[model samples]
Each structure stands twice: as C-alpha cells, then as structure tokens.
Target: MNLKTVVVGAGGISNAWFPPLIQEGIEIAAVVDLNIETARAQIKKYELKAVASIDLEATLEQHRPDFVIDLTIPEAHREVTITALQAGYPVLGEKPMATNMDDAREMVRISTDTGKMYAVSQSRRWDKNHDILRRTIESGVIGKVTAINCDFYIGAHFGGFRDEMSSPLLLDMAIHHFDMARFFTGADPIAVYAKEYNPVGSWYKGDAAASCIFEMTDDIVFTYVGSWCSEGCHTSWNGNWRVIGEKGTLIYEYDKAPYGEVVESDTTDFHRPLKKADITDSPLEAFGMHGAICEMIDFLKTGKTPQTECKDNIKSLAMVFSAIESAKRRQRILVEL
Candidate 1:
C-alpha cells in the first residue's frame, strides 16, 4: 500500500525525512509547521502536491493522513506526537522523544489510550555496521558482555540552540550513542553516575563535554565519554566503541568495520591463544533515516512493532535524562522509565 503521511516541522531535519518518504512511495499529504511559509517552501522544494499549513489539527482534518512524521525540535515532540495520536493517526517522530520523562510517558500513554502506533526515529539504530555489531555480540563471539565503552570527540561549532543549552552534548547528541548502547547490548539502563562539564576554550555557552557511567541490565556497564568542543583528533560521529565480553572484545573505531579477538584455545593455560575475529556487515535494505522510515512502513503494513516504538524508546530517553540528573546531583541516579 502507498501510505500517506502529513509531515510536521519544516526545519532542516525535516529535509532528511522527506526524501526517504518519497523513496518509500509514501505520499506527502501535507506539511505542517508553526510557520506556514516555511511549510510552503518545503512543499515547493520537494515539488509536492501537498498543502502547507500552520495548524496541525486543521491539516490533519483536511488530509486525514495515514500517519504523521514528526521532525520537530525536541521541545515540540511531545505536543506534536500526542496531538497526532489522539487524532487517530499513527506517528513516527524524531529522537530524544521529549524534553522530559513525564512528557515522554504521557506521549506513550496517549498512544496506548488512542490505540495508535507511536515510534521514535532513532536513526542510528538502523546502520548496517551497528546491526553487525549487535549481531556479532549476540552470536556470543565475545561471550557474555561485561562492559561497553564509547568515546566521541568532535569540534563542532554549531552556533544555534545547541550552543546555548546547559547540557548540550548530553541533551542534543549523546542520546544516539545511549540508544546505540541499548541496541547493542539488549539491556536497559539501571542507574547512571555522570559528570557534565564545559572545557576551557569551548565556544558553547553550556557544558559541551560529559563522562557518563551507566549500569545496564545483565550486570553490563556502559561508559560514555564525549566532547563537542574538542579541537583535534576527532572521532567518528558514531564514536569509537570497545565492547568487552567474557570470551573476548569487539572494537569499532574510526568508523571502520568492527574487529576483535577471542581466546583461540580452551586450554587452562594462564594465557590462552588468541585469534582474530572480524565483524561482517549485516544486510539492510536501508540505513539511517531511510531505515527508520522503512521500519515504520513495515509496521503499518504488518502489525509487527517498530523497534523504536515510544514505549521502548522511553528507556533510552531515560538514560539521557538520568545522566543529566546525575550530573546535577553529583551522585548516581536510578534510571526510571
């Protein structure tokens, strides 16, 4: 079926969603934004035969789209999603689900009350290499996962909202890595102890660096160290990963393919022989935003739940908020979804 959707938010991020929607044969029934002209420009840019409106309710009533794609800023995510779900339209929204856990939970509640599917587009979860990393760990090549470490360093000078936020890196960016940790380990966050700071010579007004230690389920420890203001020797946007398990470890660094080594011999020697283990890319029809769009499409076609459905995604969001809270309290905080 050729699904029809009304996309909300005509900001830069919305651009990423449109092409994927078109490629999936999903019709752009309308574009809704706070600025009607911005919405109109988006429709024009895409050469879409869709109406542009500033009012979501009016647009929904007119188009009655099959679903709603929410590309709004994090602050607007809850409102947009709740409105769409309550109006009986399934919604696929951009990440960081909501500004706060209360709002995130309410969005999930509305979706359940309305019996509509509400999923978050955690774009990183769809990467082929990420899939491979996940599968490799699941394959037990590394045995029981004990610890997962990620280091993300970048010299980003984005002069907009990100530069002004208090916990810029933790709030705006680290959610992806946090979600990826959940994706790789199949574990939910248990507790978090974090330290958020602003480094000297940083351009951002708020803390652009953070070090977080998360206690995940199955006794797995996940540590994240990142900086948005680091000047040199930057890491991949996906960060460098080191996943340690009982039998061996998997290292994904410099955005290259992941590789590791495991004990080659089961001998009781003090130091057993080690052998190389490389991760092969798993087949994926699409990656990033396109992958998320495809998953939403599949969910609509079949009753299978999309991976980042609101209920499931809230756990990842919890990790983010918990870390922030931990930073504030200067103590470990329990992650409550």
Candidate 2:
C-alpha cells in the first residue's frame, strides 16, 4: 500500500524521520515548515515531491496526503494536529503530545471525533532494549512484578523553551520512562504523587529534577526520576530500568545494545551480571533510520496507532501534569488518567 504523506515542520528529528518514510512505502507528497528555505532544503535533501510553505491548509489542499506528520515545536503541536485531524487525515506527531494536559486531551478528542489515527513519536517504546525488557516481563521470569524504576537525566538542553518553562524534568522526558514502566508491567496507574524542583542551572525547563511515585493497577508500584539539567548524560534516555518482582529482579541498562540483563524468578538472591540471551538478533535500535521505519511499517501493516495504543505514554503524560499541580500546591496531587 502506498502512503501519501505530508511532513510538517522540518526539525532536527526530521533528519531521522525522512529516510524511513521513503523506505517504508510512504510517499512524501509535501513538506511544510515556517521556513520555506528549510522546506526547500529538506525536499532537496531527501529528494521529495514537496513544495515549501508555512500554511498547512495550502499544503493539505494541494497534496491531499493520507497522513500529516507534525514535527514542529511543542506550542504548535495542537494547532497543526487539530486542523489535520478535523480535515480527515491521520496524524503522527512528536511527544509530550502537547505542552499541557488540556491540549493533549483536545488532540485525542479531535482524532476520536474525526475517526482518524493520531499517534505521537514516542519512539523509545519501540527500542530494542526496552522491547527485550517488555518481553521478559511478559515471560514472567520474575514472578509478578512489584515495582518499576527509570532514570532519564541530561546535563543540558540549552536556555530555550525547555529551560524557561518551569515544567518538571519528569513531565518533559519521563513520559517515555513512565510509559515504559506501565508497558512492562501491563498495569495502569491509579494515582500519583510527585516532587519536583528546578535546581538553579542553565538548561531547558528551569525545573531541573523530579521524582514521581505511582500506584499502578493490581498494586504494582512505579517510580520515575528525570533531569534535563543534570551534570552529565549519566543515563540513557530510554533509561536504565530495573523491575523488581516477588521472586526475581530484572535489570536492563540503556547503554547496552540488547540492553536486557534479566535475573530469572528463582535466581533472586544475588546481583550477578546478566548473561546476554542469544536470541534472534534484533533490528530494533532507533539510532539511525530503522526506528522510524519500524513505526511506519507498523502503521502500514497493522493499522495500529503505536504511541496512542501504548498505555504508558498517556500515564506518563498524566504523571507530568500531576507533578505540575503537585509542585504548585506543595502537596501530593492525585493524577487522573
């Protein structure tokens, strides 16, 4: 099946997004961005059949793409996506689906109203290491998971949108971690309590650090920690994850390729090194172009809204919004998912 595609807002991630569209049976019908020059540059760079423009309407009318991929900054996410969804087109955009919970809700609402697929590029969910961890949890090597943990820390994001805003690091980057935790446990969070602080530093999102504790369905507990203004890239964005269960513990490091170091259900006594499992060599890394391809292929074949289907993302986003409310009142807020 040929996918007539329109890619909006040519940004850094588009560098990774374009090649995959080409390989995954998606036809690049148009490329839209505020910078006509950038659009033109992208078209030339990728050899796409697109005209540069700032207006989404003009591009939509001219190209009539089956889907619109919004890759613009956070503020523009809702405007672009709402318009596309209302006009009878599916959307695949970037994450934190929007700047706030209200906007995210609206996007989800519009997509549902229009009966179009709306998904975010919460691409880490498709990572090989995380995929391995997910499988391990399902396989139940650790008998019934009890707790989930993730760490997403970055030294700097520059003094821009992220730094100026007081949003918690957890809200910003931890959504992926949160989503992963829920995905691994196959549980939904019932409530959340969080603590966040913006340690004085030069970085994105003045709020430097945050810790979120969640109560998942079936009494599974999850804790996530994130910092964009930290000292160094100590942890992988996919996060070094640890899942503790009743009888065993599973430790997965993001730095490792097939980043799963699983301790089986009976072997819970000692913290020994994970002997790498020799299974089918996975092509799940999103480092280059494959991750984007994986998403496109899934959409084409399965017709599943990947980011939308993943329960962790919504919970992750809820965690962020809840933390924001909690920080303001200096009280633990209950997250409504």
Candidate 2's residue-wise lDDT over 184-234, tens digit each? 778877777777887775445457788778888878888877777678657
In model 1, the Cα lDDT at residue 90 comes to 97
C-alpha lDDT of residue 283 in model 1: 83
- Candidate 2's displacement at residue 129, Å, is 0.8
TM-score of each: 0.97, 0.87
Residue 331, model 2: Cα distance from true site in angstroms: 2.5
Per-model CA lDDT versus the true structure: 0.92, 0.72
Model 2 residue 103 CA deviation (Å) reads 1.4
At residue 201, give the lDDT of candidate 2: 53
lDDT of 1: 0.92
lDDT of candidate 1 over 186-291, digit per residue (tens): 9999999999999998899989999999999999999999999999999999999999999999998888888999988799889889998756569886888999
